[model samples]
Target: MSDRDASTPRVILARHGETEWTINGRYTGITELELTPRGEQQVLSTGKLLVGTGKLIDPVQLERVFVSPRRRARKTFELLFGTESELAALNKVEFTEDIAEWGYGAYEGLFGEEIVARRNEQGLDTERPWDIWKDGCEGGESSEQATQRLDSLINRIRDIQRPYMHGEKPVDIVLVAHGHILRAFAKRWLGVPMGSPLAMMLPPGAIGVLSYEEHDINAPAFLVGIALPLEEK
Candidate 1:
């Protein structure tokens, strides 16, 4: 069922490491936060794993790289691939808010346990059967807004792919971003309905590969694999 030929491009998604909020299950949005010590190790392990995978972008063949504007994501890109001169000499990396994490609004610092308790006390289990992308953020983004943002970002990637089929150079694109947004991107890539919350669930410091096979322009994107190399012992 391979639709991609040799012409279609591949996308590698890198999820940023654990911030304090992530470790505590807080709904982190665009708010900038540094990775915790554990988070830093997780990211380092990812970089080490990537190097071992032999997926290093060959300076000659490497095309473009993109990172979410959030500090955690941006730092992951810089650390994993090396800073400005390092990546630029090997490949081009750009920062774009389009790939930022889901905007959580009022839920920014609350974990699942906290959310559940708060809802319970209010006599309304607002988060029951909770699906992040399908829930309202109160002072933040609605599920609709999250879906729309993912859709727009995916569309941007698609536009880049169009020209790639007609002899334009094939670009190996890498995106450094958050777990929730990347999961949504995976859904959109495969044409899955936006509400399918389980399309993909990535852990902090995970690496996911999305590639086309057999050059089928209409073929759905595939999730080659998602690896979290630095989980706790």
Candidate 2:
């Protein structure tokens, strides 16, 4: 076990706020969509609660940020971190395709009911229904593919954070991306199989925390906390 004073590297996973497709329950993979007015407000509120000094995520401790290439995710990163000048002054931000949402392929823009209907029409088995974790979209990424990409990303993060784990530097990384991809990333962070059931669901603008246990670099990683929107009085 590492010393108690050792700093634990952490990754904060922020899911983008609502889009038209998200609100409508449509599969929005690789589709560019702007945030609704409410979505923008939701992210703004989340930023206030979660980001900055003494907040859930301290800005000074943040080393870098990884963002999905999608517009919604980009907008969320912008809003959460402030204007371009502000973000540039704080941490290095990079847009990565690896962090993009699941490639929905033929299922893109289709609602769950519509996907089921389409499967029935195509003579595909509808008995178990469509679970993205089990039955990946045709012509798109499979569960194994998603797992591989996420694992690769995780490895990169570990490489970046390992040096900081001994308390030489504080490491806090932020990932702004889609709902499905972020949740899957969390599952992989815990070394869980893609085929295993995931009980965690991140709503629009939610923030999930991933960190090492006991501040030991070799310790098992776990989901630390999830920050959700405050209930309106």
Candidate 3:
């Protein structure tokens, strides 16, 4: 085991608040959507929860406040941290494309019930039902495809966080993204199969924390923290 002080950098992932589609149980991907009033409230609650935890971020020590380059996610950031002027003053946050939500492909605008109804109309195996993963939505991304995207994003995060594990630099990351993507991310980070994400459910406006334990600089270490409920303010 590498001998280093206990403070290893970690990631705190937050799901963006509800959007119009989200409120209606539609799968949102690639399409930019705005937050509803309740969504905005959730974002504010998240901000208060974070600040109230007394885990006040040391701006200089944090690497970046990475966020998905999507309107809902970006808006959550804006609401939580304020507008452009404040973000510039904070200086450690940045937007990243890798953290974008799952691409829903043709099913981007469809609700789960709609997809199932379509499946029934087509005489497709309704026994299994329609899921984003497993059976997948026709003309859209399969669970595997979604998993691949999540893996790539998690890999980027690992690349940056590895140095902190080795005591090379103090790097902390916070990601603001979507619910499904965050679930996929947590599973991918644990080296779990993406289908396993079906077992890991989170609500909109939830927070998931990931922590790591170091054994070697390059070896896969322990995931000390997994998904946990945020202070539901």
Candidate 4:
């Protein structure tokens, strides 16, 4: 257990690059999709901005990297981190289903409008708009289920950093996953309920930072920064 600085350990949540379904605004949960050409380029650009010496994220300070089991997320990690040789030399990367995209289930591969129309036809509570956070997928995880799993993951992360909590060493972790799940993770990090009306938009390949306040490990965590695409900047 290395000694960590008083600063709360940080977690960098990176959403995977664009995919065919992402470009089309379709539900791609649990679907194996590759990054588009533009997606690949954009993520590469982000890597230059966020990773490396004096960058927002210092690669040498990273303790561990967690990635979604999905190919898109894995590919994004590779692109942002380094080449094969470079990645192999750094901290080991672990792929976990815990960070995978939300399970869309019956609503998989459908556009937002399509999901609402289908739900109406099936008479599955169509009185209101289809809000995944509130309604969840008919055959997928509910808000409770998602929150439970994410909370479990968060606890694991905190445990990993416990040994380094009071030291000067950096104990940062990186999560490469999907948009919805990462967004939800950020909210849960702040101890916010899943049903809360928190409007957070993480574009493809964007990086969102989470850390504690006042350099206190036990302090409430909050978003420190969100790195947008180079073009957007």
lDDT (10s digit) by residue, model 2, range 167-202 = 678778999999999999988988889878979879
Off by over 4 Å in 4: 1-7, 85-91, 224-233
Across 95-138, the per-residue lDDT of candidate 1 in tens digits comes to 88778877777667887777767656767655465555666666
Model 3: clashing residue pairs? Answer: none
* lDDT of candidate 1 at residue 122, scale 0 to 100: 65
Score every model by TM-score. Answer: 0.81, 0.89, 0.79, 0.88
Candidate 4 lDDT over 46-97, as tens digits, reads 9987787656677766778889999999899889977662545664577898
Best by TM-score: 2
Ranking by TM-score: 2, 4, 1, 3
State the displacement of the C-alpha of residue 79, model 1, in Å, after optimal TM-score superposition.
0.7
Cα error, candidate 2, residue 163 (Å): 1.8
Q: Following a full C-alpha superposition, what root-mean-square deviation does model 3 have from the true structure? A: 4.7
lDDT of each: 0.71, 0.84, 0.71, 0.82
* lDDT (Cα, 0-100) at 26 in candidate 2: 95
Q: How many backbone clashes does candidate 2 have?
A: 0
- Badly placed stretches (over 4 Å) of model 2 are 1-6, 85-91, 224-233
Model 3 TM:
0.79
